[model samples]
Target: MTTDRTNWAGSFSYDARRVHAPRSEDELREIVAASTRVRALGSRHSFSQVANTDGDLVSLADLPRTVSVDAAGSTVTVAAGMRYGEVCRELHEHGFAMHNLGSLPHISMAGAVATATHGSGDGNASLASAVSALEMVTADGELVTVDRDADAERFGGMVVALGALGIVVRMTLDVVPTFEVRQDVYEGLALDTFEKNADEIFAGAYSVSLFTDFVAPTMTAWLKSRVDDVDPAGPDPDWMGARRAASAHHPVPGMSAESCTGQLGVPGPWYDRLPHFRLDFTPSNGAELQSEYLVPRAAAADALRALHGIGEHIAPVLQICELRTVAADEQWLSPAYRQDVVAFHFTWVRDAAAVMPVLKLMEQQLAPYYARPHWGKLFTHEPGHLRSLFPRLSDFRALRHELDPRGTFGNAFVDQHIG
Candidate 1:
């Protein structure tokens, strides 16, 4: 096993025996067919061992990066290893953009989609919702292509397959005409105001994100509005009892804004404004631990209150906490499946020993809401409870077994939770 390899966060070392970077799909197919077991490693952004394997790990970094845009079809096909930043820039040049992007654009498209990583907006769904087609090397080392139209029966399960089925190589995502967005930030919004008008506040812009410490009931709200849809000049100095910031601010308190995207109502390309961080720099306090739970929107008030009760204790090891909304989707294992959700995301100090107890307490508080943890983040949810949350768990297992009956692409993480 490689002792020198680690994830981006530098918190965990991979147990992979060897990592292969193939320059071509032909080579990838060969590696997959010859190996006893394998798993694809993208940017290694996940905090968990979701991407790790006891056997060989396949890396697509060496493959020739390709982006093919089908303007007429409203789709753009890209090498699965490409990051959202890379794809977005090229697409913007060609007058197109994806529906939404996560907080960091550096995440690989394949990894983000597989884990149901989502962006915030009352109307926007998770990133996987844009997947209409994909190509992957299955367990048998055969090339298989599937799309929504042709594979209606199984497409929902494919988009968020959790790296259990195969090593995806290329993905075709839905796109729209390029647009401009302006971001504005407001601070000290009262907890009561937010709870009473959560829906309206979220729907007030193209996208909205609220950041807090929980040590206090107040939080900051970031509103990103499409230029064509809202005033380019932006909100008043005092918006909803929160003062608009006069300068750019990083989501994490006390950090430099150099790495963050432009704010303060600056008009920029959708690709630039949709993500919280810029492509050139590392995202939010580089050394950090993350955990998120997506609970039904109806549970927002009580959920917030639960965390508020212990806010003082949470503020110590916490870097920051964020609240965002996601529209329901059909992805089989997505946290937001079939119900609109308010995602409570936590960026914690890197000490896992200090974070675990607090994390479990937070989970217990939200358990009554049936909160579903993000697949790629740190969580202690047991196998059965997790399986009960996703109605299509059995179907996803059937699909995975059909593609990899021998568990060629499976890992301990997938087996523990899925089996």
Candidate 2:
């Protein structure tokens, strides 16, 4: 099929000559080998041009949506095009679940893995960490399979490749027994109190998120705690100086809470509670731009202070800013690689012209903390500076060249930021 397409946020219009959806692996391979320039498109959730290409944009939507659970091995293999919500339901029905999930369940499995997307938790690693093995179609139309146990070195460089490698077809992810979770939203959390008890606040739940406009006197906190792991009575009335919301809340202020998951400390299935938004509803502000920076946990306090200092400048184009934590992982290109990190995510009003300057200022202010930008979000950092932030960047580039010798997957986004 052929048509002009824009990303989910409508921030970018793909410039691909054609869009192709293959019905089978054989057809996908043929399209990959014949195209001069190509990139895999998944869910179109990204705000950046990472998935853009001048030749052809290949969508795996037509591929069979298959999920096979290896009960004995405690793993589930799924098609790359399948969304997390779709896979999570199947796993829950079979008495299994993934270790973690991002804020939106509508994101495609392969896309989330490729970008090292994550949820908020002190112990939980990025989504890519759960992947034990994956299958991809390389530039030469050759199918390649790599597993963490057998191809440790190469697998580390491939998981968060920013689509500089190849088109992933299937992935085998680790699974655990299904469990229940309860979510609570607290309002009026002062910046001073949060700074003093950040650790204690985040430790209060399995996953914690803070939302703010930066200039506000207080921020909103969303806490998701496992039913079996935490207190049965639920969170306290006065949680670190913040009071529980009397009703459900959307992350963005004044918006209807209709799209949000069950709140008010009600117990529900893990798949329903983990993600902030329900699968059937649009996630976050419908028209928005996002940018996130992950700084080492050690620099959390300092990073928050720096951003607060520039609140006046950022408040104009901002919709809401979220702060979450991510544990360290071994993936070479992951933003949280090798260190526990606190991510400051911005959901900005969709005005690229005004937001770009603020983003550049953020990178400058947080440079001392060695902040790394999320691969799929909008960022203004130069390749040289970003290379310095990631110690294994050179190794990843070498792996990219080896797998895609002709740079079939390379685009302006990859060439400018990764090459």
Candidate 3:
């Protein structure tokens, strides 16, 4: 009984013969143990085929949505299927919050961590870096719990394993006391100004995002600053000649800003301001394709310059491009592993045929910079090329082999890119 299922962007339909949503952990373990091949499906936010399997696709959506905060330990254990939005609110109510959040709050916690999904912050690590522990149902139906403190050796590899090891049941993430954030959008920042003072511009706020079409003379800068971190008497609207937007503005040129988070430097909770989009509204351009390349922060200027040189070719298929910074982390497969990075993200018009050529060109231009593609986004990198990009690829493959000897979690995507 094949069911027609596609990801959030209505791209890459699943190849699984059946989809299951077990009501309990026992049922989930039984399903996993019985299947010859299996993959876990989250909120279907990924753009790639990483979650597709031929035999069965299991969704944790039906499992109990648990969110327990351990104040003493400064951590929160959330059900794998729970959305960040749901958990963040609960955490805030309990006087706690996750360190950061990706743009979309509706994405599943486990899926986000598994892909090393992240937000923009020079000081903030990928979402996976906050995982203190995680519980997974392995291929043989055994429940395994690994914590960073107890199993540091293997835990690093498991955080961003690309769903090849097992189905993540729950994750215990590090949390901090609730904090307030003020968001402001600066428009008309010239390309030269951005390139010249990139460091100061990014460090201007706790989390900063620059949105552009590559061909544009000026880009919009979305700056999210911690309220307490800023001095109240300091001069405001000092963004290197960029004018502050009087009203909220969407990243996409013509799209309505109604779905975006509050701006104009109004202080709000971390959950509300950290992510650009509001949880109640659709995130980004609903009809879009995304690709991101993470490069060493040192090569950021050269990478941006290279893109600027080919802006004409990119502007045709591009909806928008975002420049963000992420701190280094120890997650084995994380793009930001061991080095602070500048992420060049593209939100393209949803046309694979038209986007492929542009992606190839971008990849070629960025090859010298050693760019690593986002695990869940579209990319043209081959398995061999990817192996060269990630130093721990062999180790991750070994760990996968150890945990799933029969290859129960193996899928076409994993075989092609990970194996």
State, as a TM-score between 0 and 1, how close model 3 is to the true structure: 0.97
**Which 10 successive residues of model 1 have the least lDDT summed?**
1-10
Candidate maximizing lDDT? 2
Stretches > 4 Å off in candidate 1: 1-4, 282-285
Q: Give residue 390's error in model 2 in angstroms.
A: 0.9
C-alpha RMSD by candidate, in order: 1.7, 1.3, 1.7
lDDT of each: 0.89, 0.90, 0.89
**Candidate 3's residue-wise lDDT over 1-419, tens digit each?**
11338888886778889999899999999999899999999888888788888889999988988999999989999998899999999999999988999988889898999899999998999999999888999998899998898997888899898999999999999999999999888889998898888888888789999999977798899989899998775337656888888888888988888987888888999999998888988664268899999999988888999987778889999999999999999998999999999999999999999998888999999999999999999999876679999999889989999989999999988988878
lDDT per residue (tens digit) for residues 1-419 in model 1: 12237888888988888988888999999999998889998888898779988898988877878999999999999999899999999999999999999999999999999999999998899999999999999987899999899999999899898888899999999999999999999988998899888778878788999998877668899999898997556667787788998888999878888988889898999989999999988554369888898899988878988988777768899999999999999899998888999999999899999988987898888888888999888888776678877888888988988878999989999998887
**Higher-TM-score candidate of 1 and 2:** 2
Q: Give the C-alpha miss distance for residue 217 in model 2, angstroms.
A: 2.1
Q: How high is the lDDT of residue 243 in model 1?
A: 91
Candidate 3 residue 413 Cα shift, in angstroms, is 0.9
- Candidate 2 has an lDDT of 0.90
- What TM-score does prediction 1 earn? 0.97
Q: What range of 10 consecutive residues in model 2 has the weakest lDDT sum?
A: 1-10
